[model samples]
Target: MRAGWTWLAAPELWPGRRTAGEVVLALVLGIMAAGSEELLGGEGPRLAVVGIAAVVLSLLRRRMPGTVLAVTAALTPLLSGFAPLLMLVGWSAGRRIVGAGRALAMFSVAFVLFAGVTLQDSWSQQAPMTRLLLTTLYFLATTVVPGLASRYWTQRRTLLHALQERNAQLLWERELVAGQARLRERQRIAQDMHDSLGHQLALISVHTGALEVDPELTPRQREAVGVLRGASVTAMHELREVVGILRDGVEAPAPVDDSGLVGRGTAGIVGLVESARTAGNTVELRSAGEERPLAAAADHAAYRIVQEALTNAYKHAPGASISVELRYEPDSFVVEIVSAAAPAPAPGEVVSGGQGLTGLRERARLVGGMVHAGPADGGGFRVAGVLPYGVVEAAPFVAAEDDFRQQSPKAATVNGLPPMDWTVSARELAGGKERSRAGGIAMGCGIGVALVLVLVVAGGFALAFLVGSMSQGMIDPGEYESVKIGSGEDVVRDRLPNGDTITLMGLDGKGPKEPEGSECLVLMSSDVGDSFETEPVFRFCFKGGKLIEKKSYEVSR
Candidate 1:
């Protein structure tokens, strides 16, 4: 019941649904039609019936556009006020009508009705030719032009709706794909941590176990060895638990809560280099500037950088010499690992899958850092990264918010996603220059359109003025009145300076000029004519440059 009520209340959901405004418009159209008929001395039963029918049918235009349009067009000749109702019906048909053939047929019917009614009403007052021309022009302007404009508007609305729907679908699909990719990436990270760090812990346990059983060591040293082995085993167990949670897509507890993992932060950074040296590799480790503790994320990123670099070296370079350099600046930590190219593996060397560097890059980005890993200039490979002390998590999709901001018009003047200050900072840091160029291009296009419109309007006004001047040229009635059969043609030419001559055809058609090949001129009043009655026009004929004849006759309008 509530759903039905909601559906009825929302007129926007259905195009044909009548709202309060539509009802008001129908009533107003009916009243205006009736009032216009009364004002035009057409107050009678027929007038009242036509007015009522027009109002009632207009209200149903959305549901029956063609029928309403035909009825309105039929009544337009009787009630000039019905023209508005007819135009409204035409607009509705253009917007709501489906097939082009049907729309054309309906428009044809309306055109015929309008032309017939208009011709019948104007036939008595206007000549048949005039009535026909006027009827055709009126039908084109009132019916064809408005229909075409409304059709174009409807097409644009449909296109906009389609684009919006496609955009929404694409956004939904993108979000789903991103979620899946994020899950897979998190799982991969968990597995990489287990494989790399777990191996280190296992080695520690094995070496400590071997030392614990030695007889040469004192009781204190043996006890310390046992404690170290026990700690390594315990760490391995905790690592497994964390990896399990990651694989299940659950949020792992905070690093500290999960046995102080982040607190141990960059402790593994130096061990990574030492471990490589212990494993029969010629590796040199150097540090410049004072070493200071970093933020949790930055410290973790630093440890991962060294770990992945060494892992890559051990797999690809094998016995090649490697150099690891760490530079601690005032506000950042930089790590670089450079290794010489390696020879072909003798046998049983681990093959590289290129996953270590991928993980390293991900880690660096998460900690507001950048990583570069590629072949170096001197026939070696370099893996370098820079980690800032105060790290911020890089947003996964920073540009997407800009699109949302543009499409959404809700509370647009106020910042919705973030305050203007933050938005400005983000845009500047994330290619604001490119967006500025786009905005400049858009603004330029708008200015060009405005300039073109102004030019077109000015040109139209100038053309109208030129035509008016050419149409009403200078005419001399006194000189024409004095001209007789004995006058010279030169005197007549001097009287009328401005060139104003037209073919003296019958009522704007060809009639006759006295004597074949003789020069003839027609002179008439310059004042604008108001009545339809024919006016007298003076005709002059000149033979051998001498005015020979003059006559006057009425020219039919």
Candidate 2:
């Protein structure tokens, strides 16, 4: 099996060329473990050299990590931090075999061992016990922290590579599909225009030829005929261009490629407003917060989101008073387009029934961004999107689209299908960047959560130590004080000082005498009594070498 899968599983071909580095790290860890015996306990050099030899061989972990790991583990028993060496070797081997998850498990074992060693080292010291415990814990934590971190990094890199691979695959697939779609669209356009415009042109030509044959026509009539002929020729040329678009498909004559970090953001969105205003629609453009750099993907997505929103406003609700807003929030950028319903445009006034909103939604989804469109409480359409600040690579698939309106007279954005120059490309919008940044933020937060859990566990252990060991002869210094308090006027008379809560009791997985807790439950009761009384008593105590009881209060109907 090893020989058969040798090529498939070769470590040299692992992503990012990291096999060599991993091997070196494994070896270093092994040698360190080997040398620790001499430095820590003044042991003989024989065991040390053996360890070094094992380590030297352990460098092969990347290619044959399991074998190297086994050898090192068997050789390093007497060395200091031997567990760490074993763990690193495990990771070196495991990461090559399983994934980051298994490597992490190996790292966890090493981390626990380091903590145990630190705890043992910190005992019998002159410092206060609490101080000793804390220092020891932190020291152990720091010792193991690197291992834990490496585990995460290994996982993170592996996951990232997986993401990139998936992304690459997706991108390849999208391009392939986009190519086919462009071709299909071209074909559809060709069929449509040929059937419609082609017949019209043929008719126009026949009409002009008839006029030419009619010699009895007067000079004015002849001039009119000439005008008709000219119009027909012009129409034919226009139709031919349309057909050319379909036949030529997305292969634009000119090429374009560049990250267009140079494009306008606010100004670009503003243009849509100006165009709308010129068309008799009322618009207000509002900007907020300082502008920041965004990657190409986000910038373009933002622009498209706004453009489509504005287009929808004009097409479906012409003359609507529209407000366009761009705001910078804590972790994201925001774009909002709001407009009043100007009454559905008289059929002729509206060019489209409503495809803009649908289109924008699709755009948002691509970046894992979101778009919310609905009628406002005040009356009008509201389109809002939250996006990331940066990471919008200025290149998008639309760059290659021939159908995209040319940004300038002399140049245009190019797409996949043998299109124009690669010099200029569109950037993704701010919202896309925001979402991606948000995803990264979430990842950091997740790791932080793990750290928090570690701290919590350490704290609980600290607390347990305090509880079990700290005490005066009769009482702890900071025990809860006995005090007098009053209840609020609205307090229910039927209830006691404590609420009626239920605790769920099951046999718990352990046998009948299990020492654990089951789930909890809650219960409520109506007014059992209308008045409060301080008559009930229940208490027990055992701190001062004696038992004590205290009176309690209750309310009864």
Candidate 3:
């Protein structure tokens, strides 16, 4: 009723089903667009328009998807980014506006447009396969296909549920008709038995009463007839009630428990193990690694794995010892259940299969994990599943946000401590420090260029001042000549504990004023070992408290 019925005013229907994919596309576009612009040196009005538009488009994507896509596409040729995104959006819109079948035709045109833009960035179509593959994926996988596939699955599930309900109704009707026929037959039998048997019994009763009154009637005969009459009356009443129930012909459904169903967890698994042991079967449960609050999918998988294994053991092995291990790790948790093979399984002994393993696999996979089941190497059959410990770190929390945050920390460390210098620790770094680490060599290069620029600008100004002063005759011939224009060098040197020379230099236009002198220095962190460098060095004449020398740097490791 929720979906089958029409809804003009419902809020959920309009934005309805954004799909993880659309959001991902928007993110990719934003990040790639931002990165490429920064790579080419983000500046100028054109870059600003495109950058702002791409950001806006990413956030409000679903509302005006085509327009957003078009904006990004138009900006691609003017800016520097993959233009295929525009086509992806165009395809998605065409699928919605016209039809999904038309999506390919529109998307092909979009791909060609992207290829044309790509040509401007690189001359050779040498990486044609790469571009084509990426383009094709963007067109098909990221947009049109996802929307179409989603629709198909949703519709398929709805149709299946409808068919189930209809089948239930049809089955109920057929059973109702069959019961009506049985009830009619029972009614007729009841009538015949009541009419014929009751009349004869009544006549016999009268005769018995006469006999009892007569002195010739024996006590034994009187007692026997009295018992027969009583038994017949009781049978008549019981038959009538049975006839009424058959006549009603409705299923007396077992009561529905509004208390809802109990969910299985660690405790639930323990109880089930205990119950099995009580039935004279041996069962053991073991857990390893740091405990975590599992995601619903993982928890469900764990519960079902043990439940199915135990059920199978009960049906086949009966009294075999079983071991269940729930090993939690940094990245995942493993659920292993082993049960001894049945000594003599009955002919109709049911293997615990059908949907159990399938459901468990699906559950595990849903959380970016997997399941395994096989005969154990030593003896019994084993079912083992690995559930991703930090599934949400790779995805947004769709169902339980609070629970996910609480579990993510310990879960991310399951497999091992992250690679060196990489961690999920909550420690915060200063902005300057973060920039230094992330920016690295490139930042060093930038600082070098900035230093060159600053020196060039300052030298020009210093030269101009000299020129103007000379024009005003403020300097004598010797004064200008004596201030010899020579190559400048500012050296930073230090004596190491091991007695090695550490030299840092600022090289610029050759001038007499540089090198082998008291060079201006800023920060001196000697602990960094041997050397360090910074550029676009600030001087007192060009600095203040509200100042930032915004110079870039290069560091050698």
Worst 10 residues of 1 by lDDT: 409-418
For model 1, the superposed segments whose C-alpha errors exceed 4 Å read 1-18, 44-51, 121-126, 174-200, 213-216, 223-227, 234-242, 254-557
TM-score of each: 0.49, 0.37, 0.33
Mind giving the per-residue lDDT tens digits that candidate 2 earns over 358-377?
77766665554567899977
lDDT of 3 by residue, 1-557 (tens): 54522232122343434435544666677667666777878757645655556655654434554454445554555566544454345433543433445544544554555556644543232233444444444444344444454344445545655654554454456556775788888668757766786677567656655655666657776666555454444445544444454556442321222234333554467766766675567898898988887776566567777887787777767777899888888877788899986666545746554787777766665676667877887777888877765545543323455233333332212123321121233212212355445645564455446545655665575466444433221222232223222222211112111111112222222122323323322221222333344322212101222221112123332
True-structure RMSD for candidate 3: 26.5
Best by TM-score: 1
Q: lDDT tens digits, residues 115-216, model 1?
A: 787666443331345345546656665666667667766686566556545544554565567768888987999999999999999999999999999999
- Predictions ranked by lDDT, top down? 1, 2, 3
> Candidate order by TM-score, highest to lowest?
1, 2, 3
What are the runs in model 2 whose C-alpha is more than 4 Å off?
A: 1-10, 13-31, 40-48, 81-83, 99-189, 250-557
lDDT-superior candidate, 1 or 3: 1
lDDT of 2 at 528: 30
2 or 3, greater by lDDT: 2
Worst 10 residues of 3 by lDDT: 491-500
